[model samples]
Target: MCTTADESGMTTLPEISLAKLTADETRGEERQRLETACQEYGFFCLVEHSIPKKQIGQAIEASRQFFALPQSIKERYSHAAQNVYPAVARGYGPLHGEILHPEAHTDPKELFGLGIENEGDRRPFAGATRFPDEASAPGFARSLLALQATVLNKVVPQLGTALADMIGMEQGWFQRHFSPPTLMQRVIRYPARGGKCGKHTDGGFFTLVLQEELPTRSLQVWFRGRWMPVPSLPDSLVVNLGDMFQALSDERFKSTPHQVAHSGLSDRISLPFFIYPDIYTRLTSRQGRHSFGVAEMMLRNMESVAAGNGAGRAREL
Candidate 1:
């Protein structure tokens, strides 16, 4: 679906306007286009989604301010320090904290992760996220939570419904699976002179990325045994299917391999929402008996990575 090229000879990701797709007049055609993009490329750029640009800018600024805090203050919320029930994976991870690609090297990026905040939930990767003191980062938590709500309540559900439609399932079929889903928001900062965040596929169902504008293109996808740059586009979000989606779809869709090739010229910031189905919902493939819940698989993979076993290499997640 992404066949167009820009003046710089870089292939542009196929774009889908959410505004047009949501309208009654163009829903069907746009749905078909979305299906094609998923089956062919596993990635696409989303535009005109109705999310306010000003809010996104504010969220970015908040993230920058939080990351700019003193290392000791940030470490107070680190995953190693927080001891909440069910042990949710929400907190800051210093640069080279976890080895994403143990064979090559650890990732040269700092991460701040937060999940849907449910104080009463006792499920793994669920419940309240540790945030900085209000005095230190005023309104930071509120802004991020608002953005998370928008993505989970609006953007993700719309895409899930479309995907169900594409597979000839009833409308809301996939949406049902995501009831009380495990949605995680991650803010990554790759500093200048940092090494690449080595090639790996995401471990969730899908990921929606808001990449900050940078002087040089850094995101690249492996296609046809070679890596190709994914050009940055203003006022757009990049969406890509993950290994779970590919597995559940019986590989009808791809979980493309991608990586960040940090230019080492300027810092880069990216906000990604990793959406997953409910922790108890099972994933099954018509091709075999490979059925498992989203949270189960994700936790297994994360633990594997934390143990230095390199989970992404096992199943490309």
Candidate 2:
């Protein structure tokens, strides 16, 4: 367990290490603990995940390098200006370009998103990735892709298996539904102070976030009417369940509402990998009624985000 107290008081989130989460000796106990965390808080930090240190550094450096580019050059990748639609944008979005919380005036953030390079998959999020040419951001594509691959191939399946078990699914359940997962790799940079993305639940199965180590706590989770600040842990990434998880788990797991507050005096970068089932797949709730398609829910929420209004449940990918 990881618990910390700042000016906002004390907060605790389970710390589940992938090393133990998969080991034969500890898997059952750790998996049970993870399920309890999901039910109680829907958020936790992952530690001891064995992705290469070099790969992690490369991705972070590439993010900084790309974000450091001049505004004019960066704007060249703008989704709107580049003719890519908002529903499944795989390009850049300027500060205030995204509205995660409609009532929060403006979303004081800029972001770039990419994923799903399967050009032949004609689903909503399976479109080919559109990256900046090497001339624009040297090694940016290679580094990010390398790290993303590690997380997808190494980390996701392990976590997904645990999740499948949490919901009583048989073996290969995730594989059957997510053959071409609707994965979205989103990089968001929040400028220092005065911006609150508001409390909103993600509109997907879950999100695994690689947050920059910082002094101030920018991420917070809502529970029992209190805002619980998530602490920065060394060599750890954050994970949070989403509305889809809640629905599929018979709402046993809470899709805790969360937000990114000002990151003190410095800019903060959050690299979030949003995981969804295949776009064309329709999922039935645990109760055997009320079904929803991945594409339908996501596209509707994206529409809400673009219209400058509150994001629907599971509103972001």
lDDT of each: 0.77, 0.79
**lDDT by residue for model 1 (1-317), tens:** 33434345656578887776788999989988888778767889998876777778778888888888999998888987655433437888888886666574678888888888888677777878878877988767878888888887768877777765665555667767888677878888888765467777777878899888665667877665667777667788889888787777777787887888777477788888988888878767756635777767888878877776654543344
Worst 10 residues of 1 by lDDT: 1-10
lDDT of 2 by residue, 49-74 (tens): 88876777678778878988999988
After TM-score superposition, what is the CA distance of residue 4 in candidate 1 from its true location, in Å? 9.1
- Best candidate according to TM-score: 2
Q: Each candidate: RMSD to true structure?
A: 2.5, 2.4
Q: How accurate is candidate 2 locally (lDDT)?
A: 0.79
